[model samples]
Target: MATDALKNVRIRIERAAQKLGSKIVPDWMLEELVEPEERFSISINVKIPNPLNPLEKIPKKFKAVRVWHRKPDPADIWKGGLRYHPDVTLSDMEAHAIEMSFKSWIMQLPHGGAKGGIAINPYEWSKDTLEDVTLQFAKRAIKRGIMSPRIDVMAPDVGSTKIIMDWLRDYYIDYTGDNIIGDGVVTGKSVGKGGILGRESATGLGMHMALQTFCEAGEICLPKKKTAIVQGFGNVGSNFCKLAGEYNISVIGITDQFGGVYCPTGLDIDKLINFASANKYKTINGSEVISPTYMKASFDELIAAGADMFVPAAMEETITTSVAPKMNFKVVLEGANGPTLADADNILIQRGIQVIPDIYANSGGVTVSYFEWARNTRKFHTNPGILIPDNDETSVKTALQVMFKKNGNALIKVAKKYKIPYREAGYALAIERVAPDIKARNRMD
Candidate 1:
């Protein structure tokens, strides 16, 4: 259940804040931030094409979104994604939305955190079925006033993609009769349809940048000798693998939901990336490229195979207590949210393994989403009251890389001074950024 996961997330936040003493921090933030300000349970009673029978349609029942923190959304503030996974639930959305709040706050995006998902496995449906259901959801969302450019913005998540977002943006534009200019309503669209240049691989790029910052701060050199293992070759993991090789970091192992492979001499990420794209972004086989001896059928074998870095980019709580102790990595670059639970994280820290937290590490996706939002909303002459500057991939990367290095140094300094783990230091840093906003809005000062 998401309850255990939610508790694990909150406990870490509380632990970090308490070390700072709660006095300077606004009381309302601790009490209020834990609970979402808005909860949306959209009932999608629609008939979608069934793969088994074209004459009949299947019914989809539910969709959920949680707005953790934002001003009135018409201020065009909240930003997040809609995931389509069989395991998606309201509780999980709530947790992800809260994480978005932390991510946006730390990245200083012009957004608060919001997220929702339709609990369906997209793999079971045909392309037509997927598009029909996505459009239905988009129409329902528009009719209910759940989404708009001047309100909440949606992006891609697990089981979601750029084409899906393009559909939402297209529908919104058509539905509004071109009155609202719907491109800004959802991000991560095809670049031809208002998507930003870096949006495709922003999360992975952001993590890579953060990794470089942390490595520089720690005086670690990235060479071909530095091997890395990445779990999940989906968008985030695959993009990261492509870029990590640029720094001469050899990715020795890679795993998708179907299977994984390991090669101490480093696998060809380009080959695996192409294979996964053809296989729905899930890497199943690589024997044609990698030596047959390096194939790992499960994540355990890859963990057992060993590397200097391990990225649990697939799912939450993948690095549990048992997995934590078995990990051979010197550092963990969180490519997925909440991949390491509290207990497992403490285990890694105790073993002197550095953890680059997800909120900071995987923030590239939302950061670029911000750029897309700025670009899409640029046509609007209306005053929602904040001035967001123009953005492209290059300027965004330069500005954010500098911010990341500065923040990384600050977090390390605080971690050293407080004698706390890097994760805790990150939470403290995020809290410090968020507190002033919370205080000003509430007149807490």
Candidate 2:
């Protein structure tokens, strides 16, 4: 039986389609819409001679072993995240790959998704050992014709960071002797190394954008000036809080794996960042710290913590049936992919809470990755990048204002005509241009 999570995803997609007035695409139509490139043929083969190898300590973390897969996806090229955590499994990666396809389609990016992860915790391995294991995995995957810059792009995920990415990049370069995006093989690279201008803050920026958009649309004035409760203080959650502060959004509660801390008078992001940086995964709560109340809080309790918006930036399946009933927020923005389960989505929607789907919400990272690739491919040229010049934004604003005046609410009319989510509308505009090229490649005419 399909797990409740998967079922929920399908149900939400259907509901979203209905909301947009899009026809429930029959399987045959879906097959036709699925270009040949849409199917991915992956050949994943890895051999671990020692089942008991201390390094091969992943089987116990997940249910079974000998992970491998081959899937048919559009774009012919596969790209996705690779995570290492105690609960990693092949099926987990498969699901992520499916989301990547949908996400790339949503973002209008010409790519597909596939993810891989080992269940062993990184904390258990020394830096050198981790490097060796990563390189070995890379070599094995590469030799088997599985991973490559052109064939499949890989990025850091849970329990993995830029350091591991750097090591993998160097090892690939040494083996291939060809420049693979010159430190662009992996996204999320440190700033000095061709990483984009705001890469680290991209996820948070997307979350803020979602929250801001929701507030504007719903006209929900926060009780006390855009206050929020963030469940995970990892990269996405912490940076989100920090950037939210820049927008004058107050962050009240934050939790890390260890525990959470709260303060009504917004926590100091700089101090928390500095403390976490120094303490190596430890969370701080101002000068006066106490153990977190979040660890024991039900998922509903966590979201219903009297905040304007709740961000589940942590793990998947955290917001399931049992927890969705308790959420009291006006908006639930998912900073992490698939953070909310399918069943929970219906409940939240029925409650009239605007739940920002992951496809659009977390796309900033991939969008920036596309930027980094473009930069490297162009040899890091002096030309302007994705950053919209002030003049351009002003020009666009002026153009829209002029159009609105001439055709009074023309934008709204167009929006209603399309009957699409604003995010999907943005994507449709972009994909209309890219889809032609994708089609042209297979044209016999």
Highest lDDT, which number?
A: 1
After superposition, which runs of candidate 2 have C-alpha atoms over 4 Å from their true positions? 14-26, 29-76, 180-182, 214-224, 280-301, 379-445
Q: Which candidate is the best by TM-score?
A: 1
Instruction: Write model 2 residue lDDT over 29-130, tens digit each, in one string.
Output: 233332222222232233333446755533111221122222233434566666867776545555565566656555445565556675557776567556
Models 1 onward score TM values of: 0.91, 0.74
lDDT of 1 at 167: 87
In the range 133-218, model 1's lDDT, one tens digit per residue, is: 78878887788787888778899999999989988888888888754456788999998897777778888888888888877776
> Against the hidden true structure, what lDDT does model 1 obtain?
0.76
